[model samples]
Target chain A: MKKILLLAGTALALAAGTMTASAQEKLKACWVYVGPIGDFGYSYQHDQGRLQVEKELGDKVETAYLENVSEGPDAERAIERFAREGCKIVFTTSFGFMDPTIKVAKKYPDVKFEHATGFKKADNVAIYNARFYEGRYVIGQIAAKESKAGLAGYIVSFPIPEVVMGINAFMLGAQSVNPDFKVKIVWVNTWFDPGKEADAAKALFDQGADIIVQHTDSTAPLQIAEERGLKGFGQSSDMIKFAPKAQMTSIVDDWGPYYVKRVQAMLDGTWSSTDTWEGMKEGAVVLPPFANMSDETKKLAEETYAKIKSGEFHPFTGPIFDQAGAEKYPAGAVVPDGDLLGMLWYVKGVDDKLPQ
Target chain B: MLEAIILTVITAATPLLLAAIGELVVERSGVLNLGVEGMMVMGAVAGFAITVSTGSPLLGIVAGLVAGLAVSLIFGFVTLTLVANQVASGLALTLFGLGLSGLLGEGFVGTPGIKLPSLSIPGLTDIPYVGRILFGQDILVYVSFALVLAVSWFLFRTRGGLVLRAVGDNHVSAHALGYKVIRVRYLAVMFGGACAGLGGAYLSIAYTPLWVENMTAGRGWIALALVVFSSWLPSRLVIGAYLFGAVTILQLHAQPLGLGVPSQFLSMLPYLATVVVLVAISGNRRATRFNTPACLGAPFVPDR
Candidate 1:
């Protein structure tokens, strides 16, 4: 009887140990940055976020990344490589990685895919991006408060919704302060050629634009702003180095906590494939590191930040009118996630002069 | 305006200056080295990778030259040794170089690059408008100019230059004279590779101060055009390169002035100028033949 009882206890202990060991297995997480994480801006900030995951969840998580991964096939192959390496979770850090990521997610249902700056949804693939348009609105207000030409120059990459939304938001924000403010657009047909971006910025400035903002990556436009002595808001990351005096501020992307949270969710078995659109409230999007503003400008930014955080002020509030004088948003109806994320139109306060 | 123009020309001309001079030597030896673009791109990646690794500007240049030479040798084997069609092989070389650069420069994209240091000769550098424009440039710019002069003198005045030209004009005749036509051509091809590599190195290291995918931004083609546009003459390359450079830089200035011209049109100015110059220089076929090598594209077959 005693021998049988001891054997039963050993069997129970073995099962318990096995369960504990499996529970402690570190979750495999991987990331693919569209550009090198050290670019001092967009990609760099994203990389910083990935690093944050490692930092926040030391032994519980292991992270890997392939920097400078191209948007097309290169991204697909990298994701496959990551999934094959036992990664339970993968983050595709660009808008272009949407479909490719979704396709990959379908093949590997066990692994989760999180795509940044995209809207595609799937059972295993979740999309997420910062609400950058909100910050642009705040900076636009600062630009109007600072400059008199009441002309805002935009250095744009494509006619994509992401770029368009920023332009419209900036126009609305600036117009709120300066009703006569007009936003001019220049599409240089590239994402990150500083020389071209700077040249575009200069052209806009020469056309009587005293304030500048860019959708393109790189500090080139800010460099031009410094040279021309114009006020400007940064793109992707705060580029104060490019234009210390001229840089009003930028919308900072805090991807670290987001990465860490998703990793934790995987650990807790609560990880789901859900699109996440978080802004200042979730600490996903941060105001430029710190604005270099006049006292009045600082006050305006602080109040805007507080209002935005409390959900009292929405940048795309009701009674919004399109460039063609169309009533896009009804009274008391704020812009929805669908239209805002894929926005390809301008607001009433802004001009509709696109480049030929 | 002239200073800006001159500044633009030098910047634009360096890559072409490097590639054309390299091609000019190959042509002089009856070898049509169409691998200039490939060699330049290899040099670009090699130079960028080395600079990224070592952070030394000089070592980066040496690495670029070796990269260019290695790429050219691949072309040399296929064309010179195999006696393959020069035009097709050169195009292949370009395709290979571009792909190779994209692969290698993947990690370098969006990364801050090593900026080539400039030499400020106090008196010349501070000469009012010219100071920042000319004197503020790095040593490579000066080297490019020097290379042009050195090449001009070599082609027009030196015995070795004459022998190489003889080989290019007609390797059969030169080979009969016991000039070792094959050996001379080999050296010229290597020289072209080295220069093209240096040009690419300049693009990655000095001018942009950053690396992006396909960042040479069609400068390789411009260098090829510079050779023909200059009628394969060294001095004329300087003039052509600077003019192209001026157009590139002026657009940067013009767009800001918000001139009535569309931004896309302004951006296309440099390429447009290249087309115009190419057409203007290649005006008379007969006149071009006088300077162009007669058996330029023909393979050398001693036994045949």
Candidate 2:
């Protein structure tokens, strides 16, 4: 059954490819969002990138988008719809869309599919993600400097490597400043839910965490921190407006440059399936203006940011230990991209368990 | 620290209590409306939109309640007049609500909302621990408590309550006795809708104070389950809501408190508690049968 299905899929893909090849029009690109485009978080950032592509590429390429596409079989339909609508390139902007994107790509071999924060790739599928951990490291330094309670809070979304790495990087960053610095992790197991995220922030605060960080994509945690007169950082987008005085700084995902670059590659006939993970150096991740911190802390954050941007430092450098006190990376050894992309265990100072 | 935990627990529980209390009344009137989740999300989006436009959290809450009531009317009309399957109609209502709320709330996304301020009774609010818990809560918290009392009194202490109960226990007999069974059920469903709307508005206006797609999440379903877990009792509904809320809040703090369990099990605490408590409560067949509306989910044709 599998072999027959594969052959049938290949035949259908070939048919679709020839049909697309027959049409000689402007390149049509499409984007699928897991949340509404107005979420002001992950999806919103992706939409911004889409707009940037249109602005930079001009009439050479036309773009379209479908927001709030749930991940699963539903995502497969959304991606396929873009293909049927003559979208040469479709960007699935969520980790949960990985399998669906790959499946859709298999049936539309001529169409290029780019998935964000995902690991899987096909002949026509590309994977791209920002090294958000790089930004997390910088914020960790600021948290260490400003936190009077010495303990920080991390409101986590899932046990996935992407979220786990952010938690580890944040703790490592804090530990770099104060070796005895501790972090408390509260896993809400959801990517977006304002109420749950706010409650998690309160729970962390009640447990003596003066500074809060979140891997989830809502500004609720930051808002709660602001209301409680505490300090925290934002996720995905710059959320200084939401929490003003409470936000130390936000780790903003700047995907506009990367989006434009990829479309340019497609237009130039140089597009190919590749894994792209870019950080501050590549302008993929940016930290908004530092605020609500002392001048001394600001200088330290600026110095760290500059170093990361200049490739002078990597967040996962050397001598790392799991929560069980087991050495995962030896002294002076930097963690490989594959390891960072698939991180599963917590760092030594994270007061939480990694669910299997 | 304890105060902060208590505050969060109250915030989490209030929405569940509000939605469950309304559902409890509906179920008592023999209408199995599974559309609480749908009504709640509709309320959430409408509430957020109104609050954003009018700059008044109070008006936003009212809009949410109206939105929920409006959606419930569709379910009531279909099941009551058309004599449709209550279960199927309820499920359709949920799907409709989720989709429409997403469309309705499209433009309101990412906008910062004004939080409903807590009631500060001056001197009483200044009394440290006692003051903050009792007096520092928002107006909705007090309203929820009053609802529990009002519903309790209305259900067990009034002539109207007996008639509604009779209609639920045996609709055919009630209809024969000229009790207007369908009318009674419709009123109960609308009340349930109003409460759910208020719960959803509270979520968007006070709890998180922001609008996001699917902001109500699965709290409406949880509220529905809470109705059953309370064995259709108004007072027990409060206990169930708080227990669920406490478990949800504590699951996050479990690791910080150094419980040697895996975070996955801790994360499942609320759901696990729900299942365990539900099974235990439902184990008593006599008690279960006595509390449950005998004609629940059954189509009632007054003419027949």
Candidate 3:
């Protein structure tokens, strides 16, 4: 009887070992999103990149995602759970997830982690971001050329350096086209509240802004622009459908190629902790076809797009002035990435004060 | 500029008024339903989906109302019929509604909605400043005002209203008097659900004219707070809703004026105003006690 029990235990252990071996054949890549995938804005675009990984890599990879994960302490628990569940590589996609990703990476040195739009890194955690302000520069020029009032309504989310940087870039772009152009800024203090965003847009338009711009994620502002028979720019994703006649152009975030490349690196055992910030030159940022504008404006926008893509034009170059009329950078001087990443001041022509 | 601001204020206030008025009815019957956010979001998704499929904003509004009613029925069954804790069940209902609506609205995201057309009383709508503010609103805005009047009249003047208030004040005595306590509560809950649905439909179909996950965006919670801010009086609800709405819109306009105040402080103004006003009104203890439902949030089970 003892021998029979021992033989049965041995057989069970062997079966369990074989199941684990078979499961290890596929690499597990997971993602954590700050908002619902149905937002059709920031998180939705990130989800599209995850889908691209599955399509490009096929049967060799297994993917999983947790959406609407709050960027508080809950983020740490979510990332830790993925690591414990044997996720070979976990992508924490949000700026607020930076510290949490770093905290989890310290514990799981064997597992690779990537955080988006963050500026932190460790031996096991890599940070990646797109130069969305590059596209913002192009749209600012378009706003200046197309606006009859030479004023644009800018709806922003938070006072983060990323948002502040985008505001300054936009001001520079508009100034490049028409130095006397102005913008009225409203900070809604949230990333994705549709009603409040629409209210902000209406208030800006009522105050006499002819063109609308938003750094927040939602189609509400654009839909309002369409209703008011005005023009606006789309964010994060191509929202031409939501505001066909109103959308002049959209700064589309293309994270598919980057996601695919990173997943492949994990599969090839070439994963390393790196800080990557790429823009139009590397196809990380793209602009859809310009519409609702004259040919002259379209040509100018395309020319700027080409110049930025070819590395011939840097949006932050030369003669930059702060809101207090202090010179930030002299002519022929390019702003460093470190300065841009930690930017806390607004440019000369922004009509609103930075929250500091 | 004044005309445009007023128009914007009306659009912002209508949804809060719609949801608060219905919740006022539910609370009057002694049942505290905290699922307003859930019900409103369900209504939003249903309204947007139906409107997109049928291309009729009117039908979409009806569908939204029905959807809210249906979800409220589930709350009615769990809390009233099953005698579960009303607060826990209501919170669960919100979680369930938010999740289910996300699933139902997955495909409808990014789809443009057909805006509900505004009423056009030719001469009235075209007048200088007051014209568009008064006559140019969508039908739901008028419905919200009419609902306030109808609910106030029914609660104050009708015999049915007396029994409901009685049931809320003393459920045991009302049940002993042969009035159906659970039945009155059920109908009141359903009415609240339908009103919340209409408010949500207005958001998706008329206000923004698009569908996104959680599009109600905590408006239901604001509606819930407005009920308390009104001291349980229906007429006072309009004052509270519009006051709250006005502060919200005014703050947005204030941000651009470069008031030198942090945007965070501006964002907190609406909530700070709600708290201060609530404290001021709640100071009149007699009026608050007079309208307060004695048996509110307590579940009732009839003798077997």
Leading candidate by DockQ: 3
Can you give the TM-score per candidate against the true fold? 0.75, 0.92, 0.96
TM-scores of chain A, one for each prediction: 0.89, 0.91, 0.93
Candidate 3 per-residue lDDT, tens place, B202-297, comes to: 999998999898889899999999999998999889999998888899999988877888888888989999999989998989999899999999
CAPRI accuracy category, model 2 = acceptable
Q: What docking grade does candidate 1 earn? A: incorrect
Regions more than 4 Å wrong, model 2: A1-24, A319-332
Better of 1 and 3 by DockQ: 3
lDDT of residue B295 for candidate 3: 93
DockQ of 1: 0.13
Q: What tens digits encode model 3's per-residue C-alpha lDDT throughout A1-356?
A: 01111111231121111111124468989898888888999999998999899888867887877777778787888788789989999999999899999999999999999999888889999999999999999999999999999999999998888999999999899999999999999999889989999999999999889999999999999999999999999999989998999999999999999999999999888888899999999999999999999999999999999999999999999889988899989998999999999999888978787776
Q: Note the DockQ of each predicted structure.
A: 0.13, 0.48, 0.52
Runs off by more than 4 Å, candidate 3: A1-24
Order of candidate numbers by DockQ, starting with the best: 3, 2, 1
For A1-356, candidate 1 gives per-residue lDDT tens digits of 01111111231121111001123368878887776454566777897887787778866876667666677876777777678878899999988888889888989999999999988889888888888888988888888888777777877777778878888888778878888877776667677665466556755776678888888887767766776677888777767755778888888889988888888999999988888899888888788644556888789877887798778988888688887889988888988888887787778865544444
Docking class of 3: medium
- Per-residue lDDT of A146 in model 3: 99
Summing lDDT over every window of 10 consecutive residues in candidate 2 chain A, give the lowest-scoring window: A1-10
In order, the Cα lDDT scores of the candidates are 0.76, 0.87, 0.90
Predicted structure with the largest TM-score when compared to the true one: 3
Q: lDDT of candidate 2?
A: 0.87
